[model samples]
Target: MCKRVTCPNDGKPTWWGCGAHIETALAGVATADRCDCPHVPVEGNPRMFEVKKTEDQATA
Candidate 1:
């Protein structure tokens, strides 16, 4: 089962669990409150991590 988590990009609600229970984890969450940021794919590289900077943070 998936668990609810805060989106790192915008601090919106998101899911962090198996792909099978994505919809179940986000049930009842408002559409606007959902995080729509693109996520880095984790298929072959389980140990890989990525941190995306926002436009403001990129210019700093």
Candidate 2:
């Protein structure tokens, strides 16, 4: 099953993973929080559940 999280910046569902890690991966840029929708993290990091996926949709 695939999971995703919402980037509070741009209001998009990024890949499920650590938000801080994603932020750091983006070189500590605000854009990290505003990543495009469906942003799947290729690696792991801290702050995994800072922002989470919306429960409005059902997974297959």
Candidate 3:
């Protein structure tokens, strides 16, 4: 089953689970409050969780 989680990028509500259960996990979350950040694969990392670097951080 999917679980509701906070988005690391914007601190908005998001899901952490299988793709199939995404909808179920965010069923009651408001659209505006939901995190719509696209998932980008981390280079040199093959793990379940990934840390995304912001634009400023990337350029630093």
Candidate 4:
């Protein structure tokens, strides 16, 4: 099995951007170890997230 990856939101290192994103990434990493430094999210994490569907949101 592969290790979970890090979050793109991370700003602590690398290019150095989006502090809020980094914070969220840090927290996610702590819980599911889905962060890049330790785990690779693609390994065992959900590929997609849940979002509310709207009738008007859909377009032809």
Which one wins on TM-score? Answer: 3
Q: In angstroms, give how far residue 45 of model 3 lies from its true place.
A: 10
Task: Give the TM-scores of the predictions, in the order they appear.
Answer: 0.58, 0.26, 0.61, 0.19
Leading candidate by lDDT: 3
- Model 1 weakest 10-residue run by lDDT: 45-54
Say which prediction, candidate 3 or candidate 4, comes out ahead on lDDT.
3
Q: Ten residues in a row with the worst lDDT in model 3?
A: 44-53
With candidate 1 superimposed using the best TM-score fit, by how many Å does residue 46's alpha carbon deviate from the native?
4.1
Which regions in candidate 3 have their CA more than 4 angstroms from the true location?
Answer: 40-60
Q: State the lDDT of candidate 4 residue by residue for 1-60, as single tens digits.
A: 222332344422221222224454344445444323332223233542222223443241
lDDT (Cα, 0-100) at 42 in candidate 1: 52
Instruction: Please give the distance, in angstroms, between residue 35's alpha carbon in candidate 2 and its true position after superposition.
Output: 3.0
Pairs with backbone N, CA or C atoms under 3 Å apart (clashes), candidate 1: none
Clashes of each: 0, 1, 0, 10
> Predicted candidate 4: what Cα RMSD to the true structure?
12.5
Report the poorest 10 consecutive residues by lDDT, candidate 4: 11-20
Worst 10 residues of 2 by lDDT: 51-60
lDDT scores for all predictions?
0.65, 0.45, 0.66, 0.32
Query: By lDDT, highest first, what's the ranking?
Result: 3, 1, 2, 4
